[model samples]
Target: MVDILMATYNGEKYISEQLESIIGQDFKDWKLFIRDDGSKDNTIHIIDNYMKKFPDKIELIDNYNRNLGVKLNFGELMKRSKNQYCMFSDQDDVWLPNKISITLNKMKELEKVYDNKKPMLVHTDLKVVNQDLKLLNKSFFKYANIDPKRNTLNKLLVKNTVTGCTMMINSKLRKVISEIPKECVMHDHWIALVASICGGIGFIDIPTILYRQHGNNQVGANSNSLLKKLIKHAKDFRYRFYTEQAEILYRSYSNFLNSKDSRIVKEFIQLRRYNCIKKRYVIMKNNYFTNVMLNRIQMFLCC
Candidate 1:
């Protein structure tokens, strides 16, 4: 059985469609816990209607408590999950009927290998769609040029591959997520790094949800332009931010990591503080860096 945590904020436009899709999931044993983050819209009203329609299937929380934002709202719900597995849900995306079934099956397969003692996380790619629910791409990984092979600790330190809506994590890791530090970024990114260090990290190449890009999203995918990334690299201070995340992860989760991973993390932290020459030397000596070409260049320059 699974507990689905949804963080809602002014999602009135697409809330019902997403709710309906969840209602159609082949796996019916799931319990949905929704926290509306201060929506000055009909989103809460719609959620209430759905709760009324499926009293046994849904539990609503943070009714009028606005301004919690996505991170804290989801964090509150994650802590209360009493299920073997927990999943993250966006109020907008439409899940295919088999989404829960397939994700749960893959989680089970990973559990078979990693066992229950280790934290387990399994996420799938998504079908990118426009506001009208028209397909923009068949495979998000290909369309975005994503390569999952680089989902390692050092790589994940800078980039997040585990999209929350498509992710299902075991209870053990859910507990860790509930305790994530305030300085941490998204729950998915923190949870992914935790799983990479302490347990099983699995991926499903096929998409399980329709990822909507409605242009009014609270947190949508980054702009898909090399030029924009270059611009953000300067304007957003992303290099420093990524370096901060790497430091926070090392400081917070060092105990969960093995000796080698801890060393890699420590080396990366040092590399961030290193000058370009020293950074390159450390990377050359320890190879404690990402594998992707773009990310490698970014890391090299940032370091």
Candidate 2:
């Protein structure tokens, strides 16, 4: 059975539709586990009503007295998962009818190739839509210029191509990421990094989710021009931010990492102390760059 984990906050507006879509999935052997991050809105009331209707299929985690933010909220839910496969769900995005069947089929294919004991992750593309469910972009990967095939540890460390709501993980990966660190930029990025270093990552080119974009989205797709994105990254880039996360990865899984991965992680953490020219050279020599050229240039200039 698959355990679908969802983290909710003040998402009363679109959550009902999202839950309805999940309930209408073609795949039937799954239970939805939801945890509220102290929503003051009618989100909890809606969830409680759903619970009364689908007691066996939907469950509300009882430890909602305090707020744990988004990352920790999903982290706690993942730790409580006891199924063979787990998929992260947003409180707002609508999953297509075949999402579970397709993702689970890919997961099974990956397990056959890599063996079930190996940590594995399967993620797909998404369709970007406006708050009114109108099509904003047909493909989120293309709309955002994200290359999902860049699943290497070095590339993922610089930028995350995997979207949490489009991802599914096997039991091995769920156990490997038993706890998410506070230094993690996002839960999905951290999980992708661990999978890249430890085992394999599978990608489906098809879009399985209607990725909703709204004013309240925590992190939505960016349809900005190349120049605009360059300026934004230049203004927001923090070398220390990336290094701190790498440091935590090294600290947490140094023993599990292979020699080359260990070296890459160490160099990533140490590059912060290097001179500007040397830092850029190290990034180039080690191939520690993202798939996007503008973002790579921004990293070269800012780091």
Deviation in Å, model 1, residue 127 alpha carbon: 0.4
Candidate 1 has an lDDT of 0.79
Clashing pairs in 2: none
**For model 2, what is the C-alpha lDDT against the true structure?**
0.88
Per-residue alpha-carbon lDDT of model 2 for 248-303, expressed as tens digits?
A: 99998898888898888998898889999888877877787675576577766684
lDDT against the true structure, per candidate, is 0.79, 0.88
| Backbone clash count for every predicted candidate, in the order shown | 1, 0
Q: What's model 1's lDDT at 254?
A: 76
Deviation in angstroms for 263 in model 1?
Answer: 1.7
How do the residues 30-65 of candidate 1 rate in per-residue lDDT, one tens digit apiece? 999988777888988898899999999998875555
| Residue 88, candidate 2: C-alpha displacement in angstroms | 0.5
Cα lDDT for residue 33, model 2? 97
For residue 129, model 1's alpha carbon misses the true position, in angstroms, by 0.4
